[model samples]
Target: WADGAVGPEVAAAYSARRVRLLDALAGRGVAAYGRSGMNVWVPVPDETGAVARLLQHGWAVAPGARFRLDSPPAVRITVSPLTEADIEPLADAVAAAVRPSPARSYR
Candidate 1:
């Protein structure tokens, strides 16, 4: 919020959408790290692959490699500024793109 704070209704909508996205991702077996309120970091087997897959489904996520070479393969999913109705679809796309392999903690 560059201009102080948002109106009550806008704030409520953002909060509700964030919750919806978090719930949907959790339901599909996605474990997210970092701040759950904003940019969520989810480590995967291949960040590049996941981003490509998500892009095909209409959602675009940034790979960790884009910012750092030391970080493990991860995707940054934005929860805020998202639509309530699109939450489930994005979650489904994530599930399809990132599958938990053996020896992984994502379950």
Candidate 2:
């Protein structure tokens, strides 16, 4: 889940985008769910109410699950499906959004 204090308008926009993506997945008969920082079970068949409920708590559903290292309870990571097409565009967008700086550089 994405956690940030984005304005309602922005949040709604993100929500709408996610819903549309999920709807497309649903149409394809593909099940998807988002794993968030918070420990909560989100079911398939994503809907507005479910999305809103998650957002209210500062969580955004991605397309995966959260896993923890057996040896370290504190070590946890969220895994999501990624395709080659998604990687380049997503990286480019992130690069474009980040403010370039001498101290904190990203490519």
Candidate 3:
């Protein structure tokens, strides 16, 4: 392994951080898959908007459409390499992402 040692404690800390983020997203109507490990694949109602919102808050995620055709709007959030401090901001951004914006009236 090129990346140094990863013990149980390190792994557990990351898992806890991921779970917090996942729970935060769940409150926003976003669902995360990957029952095991640190795989964070969230199926958002608006992949484009979700990604944009996350990006606006200094977070990055993989768009589902980039990997598959006929796929729903989704984004991938990898929590392994990220720091635990990221959970709050990421959660806040994710929660804000699901909010409906003002309606636009077409003339």
| The best candidate in terms of TM-score | 1
lDDT values, one for every candidate = 0.76, 0.35, 0.74
TM-score, predicted candidate 1 vs. hidden true structure: 0.72
Candidate with top lDDT is: 1
Candidate 3 all-Cα RMSD: 3.6
The segments of candidate 1 whose C-alpha lies over 4 angstroms from its true place after superposition are: 1-12, 34-37, 67-70, 100-107
lDDT tens per residue, model 2, 1-107: 24565566655544554444444444544443433222222233333444444345443433222442332111111213333344333323222222233475679
Compared with the true structure, model 3 gives a TM-score of: 0.71
lDDT of 1 at 105: 75
Question: Which is superior by TM-score, 1 or 2?
Answer: 1
Clashing residue pairs in candidate 1 are: none
Q: How many clashing pairs does model 1 include? A: 0
Query: Candidate 2 — worst ten consecutive residues by lDDT sum?
Result: 71-80
Per-model C-alpha RMSD: 5.8, 15.7, 3.6
In lDDT terms, how accurate is model 3? 0.74
Residue ranges of candidate 2 with Cα displaced over 4 Å: 1-4, 34-107
Per residue, candidate 3 scores C-alpha lDDT tens digits across 35-97 of: 545657777778889889888888888887876678677787778877767777787787677
